[model samples]
Target chain A: MRVPEPPREMYEELEHTADWALRVQGRDLPALFVNAALGMMELAGVRTGDEPGEVRRIELQALDKESLLVDWLHELLVALELEQLAFREIELQITGGKKLVGTFQAVPIISMDKPVKAVTYNELLIQESPDGLEATVVFDV
Target chain B: MTQIRKQDFTRLTPYLWEIPTSFQAGMRVPVRLYADERLLKAALGDKSLQQAINASMLPGLVSHVIVMPDVHQGYGFPIGGVAATRLPSGVVSPGAIGYDINCGVRLLSSEVGLEEAKPFLSDLATALYRNCPSGVGVGGNLRLSAKDLDRVCREGSQWALKNGFANEDDIARTEESGRIPGADPSAVSPRAKQRGRPQLGTLGAGNHFVEVDVVDEIFDEQAAAAMGLTVGQLAVQIHCGSRGFGHQICSDYVREFQPAVKRYKIQLPDRELVCAPLDSPEGKRYMAAMACAANYAFANRQIMAHHVRRSFEETLGGRVADWDLTQVYDIAHNMGKIEEHRVEGELVKVCVHRKGATRAFGPGYEGLPEEYRSLGQPVLVPGSMGTASWVLLGTEGSMEQSFGSTCHGAGRVMSRKRAKKTVRGDRLKAELESRGIHIRARSMPGLAEEAPLAYKDVDAVVEVVARAGIAKKVARLRPVAVIKG
Candidate 1:
């Protein structure tokens, strides 16, 4: 019997002094959003509580897809700081490469190893990839 | 991205290098670097020089883009980079000032001798950790109403004085008298205000710290005496910024400028470098909002200073006869200021954006305090965790060459990911403790990321600036205890 190959990682951390960066990939725009959210939470070492989580929705519009992705991730970060919520599952819808509507099942954050200050647009460009789309995001910390 | 090579630079002097506009297309002026050959090689290992070159393309830039010896790669602008643009037409990029607006260092000297304070070192560290709110997701002791928050936005350290967090001398020693002019709270976003309301007086995570040190050496007795430094005496350094408030403000502006740049027909190599003309409405509003964050940081440090003084008193009041901590200086390294500087033999007003650089005004500047008018401004250079920090003075060379600025701190050479992968926080803490240094931290991974090996040699960085005549060293401080989040 042949062994199945392990799935590829949705995101990988990049090297940056004084900040954090990650290269995120997905099969579609919505997947890209989901992976970015997960990657950010992972980089911050966020751990969640065992209680049943709550579902929250966010709607945002921006000038472009890159901006929309940033806004989405920023919303998640704000929720992590203000509401102590960490996303367990994320579903996103992209409209016209400018609008994003998303719902996430969030659990109470038990602990975080670090904090990301802000999401940046430094050299940020969403490009075509073998999977579907890819982009590099830098977070000030 | 193009790879930078050593052959690409013109060796102007033993400590200075220049990359003329002829090296690249669309560069408005030359990019000057202050580094010895070895430091220059380290800069070539990263993309910081390229970021400086990109910054040179900004409109109405005067002289050249100045890169300090400790320069490192940042998102839009290189850390330890300085740029001045002519007013009326020049642009002010938010990234050039950094996300943590007014992120700075405050040094306080004391009459307490190291011998007298030795027994209370551990207790002092514990007191400081308990008194100062730190780490991620921690709220401060005071909650502000909307009106009181606005007062902090406008009044800066004066708000702390009114609230009994600071004395007049502390304000006098602070940069811009602990408050920048024209801070309009109305211009700040509601989201930023909400974030600022809860985070005041917090030393947020990611390299922000409070360290206690002993004056190990004094390079200049006159200058050191003027700043209240004495060998074998204890001192405290508070390093932090505006916290979530500043981050949200910078994020809001950087996002808003994505559209404003298009409206102004501004062309930038990177989207993060997006900016607006200083005379434009967008630029004016961003400046106003930035001032609010700047003032907020000033007040934050003032309140932290109060707690630090209390911590000292609670631990060593009777043990040491004179345990009072006096203000040496408070200066911001990450900021954008409107000032007058000579360009091409003409005195011109410009906006000097110092991302990871400190304003090092030399002697004879009227803005300095009366005691320091002839002694020049005090420039505090904090090292990475478990290293020697320096006290330096601004020089006339800084006024002439680097727009009244000098290196901020020991710049990072290794990435956080690489550091965390190779170093264990528990082992590092044990090592430091064995060296007689006390450590208090909330996160192991965060502590691992700030290991000393991850940064450049601060002594080497200071030597480059001193040899270049941009700044003069005064004293060296050795860490005895540290508190971090």
Candidate 2:
């Protein structure tokens, strides 16, 4: 599995009174999606304390890139709870037009800072920035 | 949207203000607020007023959109907002109800006095933290199959009753008797059920907690006695909603309604405000799915309350004469309910969407449990952790002016990130401990993020609503211990 490297300052947390919002940017759609996943896992407080590792693959398709990002992050949230998995390495690749196959080097979580309840469509907009693409994702925590 | 200045509002009263429809073109109705000048300034500090303006544009809105004193910035709509859409052809926006469907607060009163339990307060906190499952990535005791989970979606607190996690009184005291009727399990998606199944009875993270409090003051003695709340007596407040179950259901519908908005030729300033006509097939399906989530939340809180009672029994039962914990009332702050409200002195059937607000139905509302019918519906407003929570009663003014809705909590003033940066969780815990409040939290950072300083003063928020006559003060509760996820 090919582990992915994210661009510097790909994502940052935005100030929200009631929930967490992430501002993410990347060179392309795939990078944008991966960076958003990493940013979300970061907000979930995914820790690295020499935790046990598991390699897993996820494949999904959506109506478009925005939905794709929401779907990807949502899948991570469910896995974090149901499977007790946190990402250690992130890998994603576009396939067959709308579909994307991704790999996650996950860990048995020692602990996370907080729980991200749901990734919301509230003000979710994937835009064409000068760099490439950027978006803001809000969460129900 | 134009910037809303306090000057733009015409003061209707000491605690009421309004921005007339002429303030904004295309506004179907005016936007009203229950706030004093100070609280109005706090609301104008954020984008809440602009969001309220957006809500006023919604078609079929009855009268105006009511903003509570605790109003703050939220996604598509302001948090502390209540809007009623006329029946038949009016719209229902899931964004207006929030992601955690039926997210609410429940108050459980006990005969045990805080003075008697003071010695065991530490043990009680530990016991509660251990017994009631909470925090990130935590799972509950019960694990259900796909079929049983569907039943949970359908049955709500009744499912808990059948599983020995709840009592008849527990169901009866809850909103909608712990189930939103017409919950069609088929309306819920498989993925939503899967996320919901394991989280049942578990207090999922972020702004959710089980707090042990003392009824510090009673305003309406008769109402307090009816609700079994006495000054100095201990009460447990469970603040959470339908965990992953509700979130998934809302997420599924919000995504589905994106297309529905386009098909209906709706013009929304924000994509998140996607909605459907009340009579459309999508709307019926969403209502059914939302009902399932609402029911699940009722059951979720009921089971947690049950476990909390067990914990109280284990830690304080032998020492106290009575170990029984009775349900005062269980109310949902985030919900969409079909109710009758008078608009312009004419009664109309409407669907009221309360995002981060409580249903403060006046006395004589048929839906309230028989005991509370005379006292009005009990509104439990949990302040931020380490602050004062409230028990208030609905009023005729609420039914007449605000569609029987009041503020939910001490609305957040600072962002979670800012709270973490400004205050250390451990230091905040120490501060609360110095104030004699025992705390058992999963993460210090998590605890810091919910600092009491992050929210508006609960007393002030309560005063505004009380003075406005939307809600009458019943009792004030001061926390003695807190357990957080």
Candidate 3:
């Protein structure tokens, strides 16, 4: 599958580094969240390999979608750190009320580097859309 | 997202709103938010209001919980939240102080100007990045054993000065004079100790930075003179905290307090706001441990300041005295203290928790150094990289309005992932450089997350604090070079 390139206006590239950002934009909430996660992995350069390991099941319920998204990413990063797995593909099923259940395919972390700190609410957004949802998230990498 | 009903705000004045006790059961007093219309609207989009309301429900709160203009959602309490609870009756909540206790900024002024430092800016930044320990879990040059760590936790900057890590001027200018009384190292958890052992003098990642700034403007000439700040003078600002040590201590206490809150029959609107009575064993233990972390942070900044001074001396080739580098002030944004404040026309001792906020004591406050006694405490608000940072002074109004507190920094307007998603670190660096601001960091992604666009306008935030009369503007320092950990 061809990886979608982020919108040009969204990210400003840095000097002497492999990292990139999307400063994502979408009309719907779910789409924004999905794109934000995609953008983070893109910065981590997690797109190339496809090992397709065991399926990892995760479920989280937060007070709101914003909190839910933060918790979801935090759990995912923690799992990646502790389980030594990179999730290549994720199947997210959101139950309108702050709960999300997902099944993800793990990619072995052969040479993973860099730890992400806590997720911040800085410039985070979850907007309503006719099609679905859109959001923006900032991760302290 | 959960649909939380916005609470009807009762305007106490043009700048204050009260979250009445009737709004939620178990609230000992109302919660007061200090912000203008714009800030309030922006806050409506976040969970900070809910957090402040939750904090009001904590046990033994003396009066209304207060939120500053720079408020943003944070764990347990709003980042700019302040709550002062009547001691013995009120309880202490570790969450109110935040994970990074005493996470703060320290400003150092130099006799050198931009012209003198312009030639060496890049080398100076490089030297700072090389000498200072930064990034996640990065160890510092000086490793301390358990005994040494105890001295750091208990004595704070005093320990640093004794070991030649700081100078006399640094101590005199530092808040609490580099030591917070009542810090009992024994109260610190073993895990906290282990984490702090090798982290001294290190700048942890995420919003932590060391910037070379030029005093672009001085708002109050008298205050600026007292601070030794002049237009075009060079200064260094170090932004960091107690690191893992404070995080672990907060974690340990938050967990400990959860059970204590239940045992004490303390009703809280949010689980994260768990707290125990201030006089209780649980609360005392938490405060003691919190002080230990606060002291640790003070020492951390002092050592880092020493390293900065050394870097400047090495790169600029000037004698230490000739450098004329001296600490202006150091203030914490996260921590709780037992302080005296007037409540309902009477003097009362209350436990004040300022998370992502700074204490802005006005003139005549006993806590300020003698030199600044007539001027008030200095409040440092650092903007995002490549932006202007400000120095404000405490006012008498702050004592009555915010329990002697003010804003901390330009509150986040974007999440890190969103900022990174929107901006590439390299491009951001280039953009800043093109605009004449030098950028240096360990990770480009880190740089992207801290892009200036990710934060609220520091100018606007400072204006609110100034207009609200909690703090008065002192000086505006613009970054010439920024180094992020």
Candidate 4:
């Protein structure tokens, strides 16, 4: 299932040597972060259970755009593993491309196809293209 | 960044190949590869060689970078690669060490004959699957609070010993006595500790397993005897790492070291290869935190071994005359160690970073335990599922060439997606069962990704290293049962 993203935002899987990679694009940083979260959830194969859990808020601020992206996904992984929550409804706002505050409607995880160990900074770059912000995220397995 | 071909390499021997320093700019050393004909082509099939060249650019590198037969593409540095940097001046890159800190393997030998235990194989696999907590989001058997978790960092396998899960011999036979020195929990991030605390003894998902193997062949009688390997006897292998604890540690350091590269003025071809001077504060802290994860891994395996022992007793204790399992050796494949090696005929200390490579310190090295000192360290090379695992002995040649390191396992040749597309997991399980292998997996798709055909032949990988004299073969193991998360 495709993760819901802002209009005009897109993400696709990229072939990597040993790990999973995704090429994501958005009209802005907020759109990009939203799609990237969806891409990560897709890569991890998150399955939601029948019972809905609760609404959780994840507020994080990174030094830069790349850090912010990593922090966002890493937080989601922790929530899924530690709290057993899988968020399907996500609202994201990137404040001046630095601060990020997100609210997610989460449910219990029924299953995961595989573990994405952690998101890595290996050749991670958030670049501005003609279309908008584009980046490639690599996940260690 | 260009694709490397076999003709690009200079053949130093039938099994040894080298790429001169002129091939890349800012290289402090050349790249030397150990692989045979077919294996050489396999190494060229991906970015493994270019990654090795990228590794050669690290500052203060002593000798040429070493590439093993099982080389494959990996983030930053290639798997089955080794590089040693000069002490105090060299750089430490967490990327080269990998996300799974001290991801290693431990072998346990049992006296239970395979013939006597054949009927109970299915039960044994089930018992192992039930007892050892595995799969995604599965917590460990024991949950440690913040304080107890700190002790897990500083003490390592000793914590398992104190908890009555490990024995004296198990500790003595482990690498670094199952605890790396200089582990400072204060250096580890609070987030890393929180992720690690509840997951201390878990065998997390993806490529991790507990396999029951039967000794199928013995190549070297003396070495096999020392390891207590008797053909037709049951043996257990635990392959895993530090779990999220190590992942968080590596992630934090890799992110933190991003700016350290500019401060040290060390030019890197890849951003993932960010590093700092060995004596720098950033580097020291990374090493300290890495040590804690390494210790946690040692303990993780210790506890898992304890569970393996329990499973053996529960399944075979009554039927078999003796169902006890003894420790052969436990060694970390992904690790960075400070050791003295001869560079240009002069002995000096260097930090050896082995990524997807096993430490094969030769006989007479002071680091080896007493019984193994004369016979050389046992280099455990587990094969792909249902294939033959190997036991090899380190040689003096390894010390001279590969910095006392060798291949880790049957490196991946096909991507997980491709593997999943090509084979059905349920069908694969049935096929393995037909061949006398019992399988218990939390997820069937995870099994398909690790299908035997998706990896390079383990026998061929071992042959290249043995022919190159980095290590010698001792015995071979065939899988009879496997438990995967």
Candidate 5:
């Protein structure tokens, strides 16, 4: 199933005492996932090189939308840490809120000011909103 | 969100407060908080108490959930929270133990006087910053193969010792001798191994650092002498953990436990607090994998200690009479240890989960080294950057009250975002440098995020723990040099 790209009111950083939190929204599940990834990358201060990007395909399955979101973000986090990979462009397909098929243009990261250690499931809930869907995530820094 | 009011708590003592099970639904145990009036107000300002109430609902919890004076809001179980569940069928929540498994502090005392080392502080800081890898996506010089990584998973600090990164004395002074048993490398995921491989000696970013301090005050001369801490002398504190390896292991388990909770029919108020029984296959695997990460952290710190020693030697050897730094103690703040604690007058086996809390085993515990056994285990409490750190000793009160645990650090009072907004990293660095403290940091924004104003006062936190009898102050340390990632 496909939906139009969400509005730019994608994600916003929320205040957390000891960690990083992001309040993310999307017109659809795929948009929500993409925006969440972009929010995390921005929060960590990730910057990429000008070199051409490589399109990579990612297929992931989880118990639910929240789990899928965490798994997806964590996949990007690991790539950023281990391989210095960041997404330049993203195309995600969501099915039943349990499986995700994403093809993102991976670019080499030049630098990241801070490291986002792990994506947490703290108070994590993906709910229906008038706009589409909304969820908040906490990242352990 | 459940709102917890200050008036809802029953003041058990001047420094101890309690929220009985009646205060919330599904609570199996009362939540006990160790905080003075002001700190209690601070606790109420956040959702920490509400999280504590949620933690008390975990299955098989024994006694009460202990909240330290430095308690603050975390995801599910509040940071600076401690809870022990009866063994065999007791539940183990990875979130309660935290993501940075075995994230801890190692304190090494030195005989070199602060005055003598003052001139060389800059060089020492530079040496440390260069020797010990810091910053984001940084890898250490020691690149381990898959087989060697397994050895690290199995041997911990012993591996460092074999590789000349640690000494026998260093291992002897460490908690659990720098290696935890029941670590099965097979239990760890390949992704975790991949992350742990090259980051052994690196100090990754976010609230982690290597700081050189001057022992400014000795609260207990007897205990201080035993730990080789003296007024006017220098000390080094290395604060970090298992790095990416531990984070991955924890993330993997926390995700795995999401469904495990459903399988075991354990109900939790928050999904982050998802757990499995100790006897269950899921729980056993998590424990084994967690131990591997714990051991990896032990080796990581040990290797960093070696680099610290080398940096000290290279910078201060020819100038000072002695530049050697001896291990005072190394203690993990985030961990789940299986031990026996006296509960309700009966010695029972339990899994004590300390998330952002330290194990402060009192005197006479068999786990302590012979010399420290009479004085209790030394607890290393590294303060916020630019603030004073503390050296404390465990007491009988900790055994009876907090499951042999105490506060970890001056817990965060302000959000990192707020800190960055309020304090410019360059300006803060300049201020500390003007105060005669040498600073080496990775990024200005990162430094801004860890501004001292972001955390609670360490002295007040120590006072609360000291008054509560969970830990006793031994020495106070003021930073002279800081190396941050």
Candidate 6:
């Protein structure tokens, strides 16, 4: 599998902190949300290991895609703590009108470095894009 | 990329503007902004306007929602936003008070000047950092059992005083005498209690700090004198709140409010602004929980002040009494109170939700201590680290215009992520040191997020607040050293 680099032009360099964020552009809502989530986890160097032992499922529905993305991530975090499972990757399928169904594969919890505290709404952006819909988000963790 | 168009404003006066209720659906009142041309323009470039507009949609809001000059975008409401809603008829929103309930600033004045304390600057910073618990998830030295935690929640700063954490003078100087009435420990969740159990006196990370500053200038001589502030004197400012306790409480309630808003048939422009009627079960629970958190914060700061005094005594080789280290004032920024404010000619009890805004009640208000009756409440505005903080006195104008509210601080201009990308923490630290500002922090990344450049100019923010007549500047304080969690 090949990992792709996010486009450089999509992100502006933040002046005083230590992370990078990408302003994602997409034609569809689901793609944009997934890209934003990927960008967030990428900044923190989040990755899943190959040792899979358990299957965890999380579902969320919100009024809009922007909020749906937030709810999705929040659900994932809660699952990580409650189920004591560490997942390497997620497969998300959005069925319009604020509903998203996803399947997550997980392994036994291992010692992890750098925990995310909570997500904040500061500097959150969602806008119309030439391709579809676009958004940028900054998480507090 | 598409460029976002700016909204038009209707000027109500020299310092006020109207964001008409018609601007958005479900808005109960118009949004009022308290800022001049420059500040307003800067605010337009940010998301403060959108947040304020969203907050105006809160249920049962009266007259107009207000934002101070230092307004900036925040969760649920703009950081400097204020809204008053009729109690029982109106609703209480946790987002209005913010996650860090009663997050506030406490100023301590000392007779010693910067020149006298220059030689011991490092020692003082080290002492304070050592004595004060800081960093993410760190516990303080004083551990509390369930019984004691309940007492702290119920009594607030009064509990601290009873436990030898403060004195009578400190109590008199504190806002609300360090305890807000109506706090019921039983109303608070067990999770929140568990979080608060070992965290009293701890400084949680991200914008929380203890700074040593010099009184650089006095804008109003008589007011400054009355506040015991003089040019060149040294002072300490501690900025923190209820930590995980408050955060968990807000999280719990924001989730709980979702269904409450729906059940009440309420409409909102933003879901984050979801609320419940003040008289409803959920609303009463939130207020009680909020009071618990507010009291926890008051106790937290009182304990920190005690530690600060002890550190000073230990470092100077004697009691700090001769140093004249006394409590100046403590004021909450993120809170919602049932206050009596005149609305359209009637003195009605309204729930004033001030998120990232300060209550600057004028003189003669019944809440203030007798000693400060003539002087009004002391409004402490802490600037970003390496910038000039200020002490201002509330004025009658505040009551007339803003429900007795004022700007909180030098609001953030740039996002923390943006700031971190532009400047490395190490380089920023070195730059500040070059300019003679010593900074001690638990993490370099944390320090980077709080770089002074990330915020609006404190001088300009203070000037606008003073010129607007809501608050009168008494003293300007320049930082000598900062210890951040």
Model 4 lDDT tens row, B1-485 = 66678877999999999998888777789899998889898888878899899999999898799998888888788899999988987989999999999999999998989999999999999999998999998898796989898898999999999998899999988998999999999999999998898898889899999999999999999988989999999999999999999999998988888778878777888877888888999999999999999999999999999999999989888889999999999999999898899988999899999999999989897777888999889999999898999999999989888889999999988877678789999999999999999999988888988899989999999999998999999999999999999
Candidate 1: segments with Cα more than 4 A from true spot: A1-8
Total clashes, candidate 1? Answer: 0
Tens-digit lDDT track of model 3 for A82-140: 44566656666667748877776777765432455444443345665543455545443
Task: Please give the lDDT score at residue A89 for candidate 4.
Answer: 71
User: Residue by residue across B317-391, what tens digits does model 6's lDDT show?
Assistant: 552325657998999999999999888899889999998889999988787777678878899999998889989
TM-score between candidate 1 chain A and the true chain A: 0.91
Instruction: Record all residue pairs in model 2 with backbone atoms less than 3 Å apart, i.e. clashing.
Output: B135-B485
Worst 10 residues of 5 chain B by lDDT: B1-10
Kindly report which residue stretches of model 5 are placed more than 4 angstroms away from their true locations once superposed: A1-8
Name the runs in model 2 displaced over 4 angstroms: A1-4, A49-55, A94-101
TM-score of 1: 0.98
Per-residue lDDT over B1-485 for candidate 3, one digit per residue giving the tens place of the 0 to 100 score: 22334347887777777777787666677878777777777777667777777777776777788888778777557788899888777878887887788999999998887887777888888888888878744778886989999988889999999999888888988998988888888888786787778788899777799998999998899989988898988899999998878876876676566557778887666555778888888888888888898999999999899888888988887632356578899999988988999988999999999998999999997777777899999999999887889999999999988899999998876766578779999998899888767777877877787888877889988988898889999999999888887
DockQ winner between candidates 3 and 4: 4
Q: What's model 3's interface RMSD, roughly to a tenth of an angstrom?
A: 8.8
C-alpha-based local distance difference test score of model 4: 0.89
- In candidate 5 the C-alpha lDDT for residue B55 amounts to 95
Candidate 3: chain B TM-score equals 0.96
Q: Assess each model's interface with DockQ, reporting 2 decimals per model.
A: 0.77, 0.72, 0.07, 0.61, 0.85, 0.18
Q: Please state the i-RMS of candidate 6.
A: 5.6
Ranking 2 against 5 by lDDT, winner = 5
Q: Give Cα distance to truth, residue B162, candidate 3, Å.
A: 0.9
Residues forming the 10-long window of minimal summed lDDT in candidate 2 chain B: B266-275
Alpha-carbon TM-score of each model against the true structure: 0.98, 0.96, 0.80, 0.97, 0.99, 0.85
